[model samples]
Target chain A: MTAPARTTSAAMLDEIRFDAAGLVPVIAQQHDSGEILMMAWMNRDAVAETLATGRVCYWSRSRAALWRKGETSSQVQRLIELRLDCDGDTLLALVDQTGVACHTGRRSCFFRAARDGDWQVIAAVETPPDELYGDR
Target chain B: MTAPARTTSAAMLDEIRFDAAGLVPVIAQQHDSGEILMMAWMNRDAVAETLATGRVCYWSRSRAALWRKGETSSQVQRLIELRLDCDGDTLLALVDQTGVACHTGRRSCFFRAARDGDWQVIAAVETPPDELYGDR
Candidate 1:
């Protein structure tokens, strides 16, 4: 399924309120299961890239550059839908995630739960990062 | 329900990874319905306030101070639980919302649906903003 309206990229970009660091927070969710996979930051270019390519791309603060999800680990996320919150400061990307979404090789990055005043590991790693990354 | 184990505020706070601005992105969801109500930012103090008081509080980037949800519009969100994502950059707040959670008096701030390339409003205002805010 596609968006109902085909708006100009400029107009869509204009709606977003990027922070002083020129980044916006985005949540990646499993399209089929409605499970939240991870949260990351995206710059204008990363946003443009994901919309244009249908692949989830993010702005790596540490790398100071565009980072493509699953590029290194091969756990790619195929974009099924991209949604912007009402205020446009946040985004939710529904994706068909492959393998795992966490560096720890878990199904989701939110694999821990805060309960009883402590953090508990709710889910275990589905695939080890060693296997997903395979040497570098 | 209560957590299996109890922890301290300092321990919980230390696990969080606040951004350079000392803020974290928070998503408030309806505890029973699983519907997302709104997104907000929180500083360390706001985090403590919500946990200590069981009332959701956020940081107003514009006002540069603590903002208690529903303080003005009476759309209070009582904290059901607090969760931190694995990396600790994002927070999920399951809440018992008393009224509409949007400033526009909608049940949820995410009232729009992006479909078929267009933005379609899926939900309507539960209470009109005029009545909720009342000339404020």
Candidate 2:
């Protein structure tokens, strides 16, 4: 879709836009160090919560509720910066994360080995569900 | 944009499809456990690499190259399962990750703390750039 023109200042809220889904693509990054953390979807409420509360909030399609990153496992993400792409359909959220981002107990959920031409399993962290989430 | 109908399966290639960018959204999960890891983008080549070598591979838009997860810091990921959403635009990769996923050295990149109405920096893992990049 060919979008309208974009402005560089926060006063250009008229130019900044979101999709029909009321959701924007958010790219999570590590603050202070400036490292990319992860990418997720956020709606207006999620955006508001993130900005107002400083915690990373995501609209969970599966749960159909607002999901605070690292809620269950005590892992938390603090917001550093909220950036909008030129089109304003995408966002970049610089955050400071805690504990593990992935449910598997690793720092991130992107832990797969790609080598030669095959997808292989390499390393893993976290205890099995039988132990960690047995009650659930 | 409303997408067309697509096939859905979990039998590797039979389950997922990619866009013109040759990339698919991969959701990572912990290996030894069934924790939802982080989500990332992977191109067909990256998928092929992961399947071929058992290592996690991702397309680095910044470096414009193929990135093997944990290639630099000895923090590797092993693929457990590859799942596809009904839309075929998304992929769920079950993996086992080693070491830290975030560059900051924490187990994850999402380490921010949210309290009251403020986002605060909390924990951070320290990693030497040389250890990860090797003077690249």
Candidate 3:
């Protein structure tokens, strides 16, 4: 007997409504701990690929590639839930994460602290990208 | 001699460019561990308050009020870092978080796992709304 066909974009598209830019907002969260990680945009293919595989996939507006979260750091995000807002233009993805989520090598891209009406640098975990990304 | 006054919106506004809606995207991250926490929207005042108090403040689109992260739950987000995108339309905030970031009671909002063309429920930390939020 042959295996069943995989779920395609056409099937999932009914529930997901993309914006005019063909992008849907994706909210990332930790799996076991249940903390929100970050939010980004994903195109149809990115969503489809994420569902097709356990890995969280995003459309990188900057690089224009299918960004599999943690592909570089091996801190892959395993999808848990994909929710749509009332407008159907946004998505909330619950995921299990492995390592630092930010490219800066920090657990997240957010790293600034606001104090005394000024945005100040407070905490950082991983080393800055001068060494990781190699000089800008 | 008097101490210097804190930076005002007039000065900070010079650096930030809000979208037509007068809302800017704010990214949240963990403080001590350096993990990406979450992303939300903020208006001009919310930005000012976050800086003034060292607490993470956001503009709630649903309620239209200034939301202090972890206000209700005591899982506060202490401001650590605030960054600006090249265009100055987006804001990145690094914060020190106290508790779970998700309404569901998880450390993060993300908890679903996607695998084999389907979204699978992997981990759940927070209790359901019926228990946590208490029936709206």
- RMSD values for the candidates in order, in angstroms, are 3.8, 12.6, 7.0
Candidate 2: C-alpha lDDT: 0.59
Candidate 1 residue lDDT tens string, B34-54? 666778999998888888778
Candidate 3 lDDT: 0.65
Chain B TM-scores of the candidates: 0.92, 0.73, 0.81
In model 3, what is the error at residue A97, expressed in angstroms?
Answer: 16
Most DockQ-accurate candidate: 1
lDDT of 3 at B54: 70
For candidate 2, the per-residue lDDT at A35 reads 37
Which segments of model 2 are wrong by more than 4 Å?
A1-40, A43-46, A49-136, B1-15, B33-37, B126-130, B134-136
Ranking by TM-score: 1, 3, 2
lDDT of 3 at A122: 45
- lDDT by residue (tens digit), candidate 1, A6-121: 23366667777898899998878787776677889999988777776778899998899999998898988888777777788887777899889989888877766666677778
Q: Is the docking of candidate 2 incorrect, acceptable, medium or high quality?
A: incorrect
Higher-ranked by lDDT: 1 or 3: 1
| DockQ of candidate 2 relative to the true structure | 0.05
Which window of 10 residues has the lowest lDDT sum in candidate 1 chain A?
Answer: A1-10
The model with the greater lDDT, 2 or 3, is 3
Cα lDDT of model 3 by residue, B1-136, tens digit = 1232234456665567786789987756575564544557899988877766777789998898989876666778876666754345667676777766767676654344334444444556754545545666
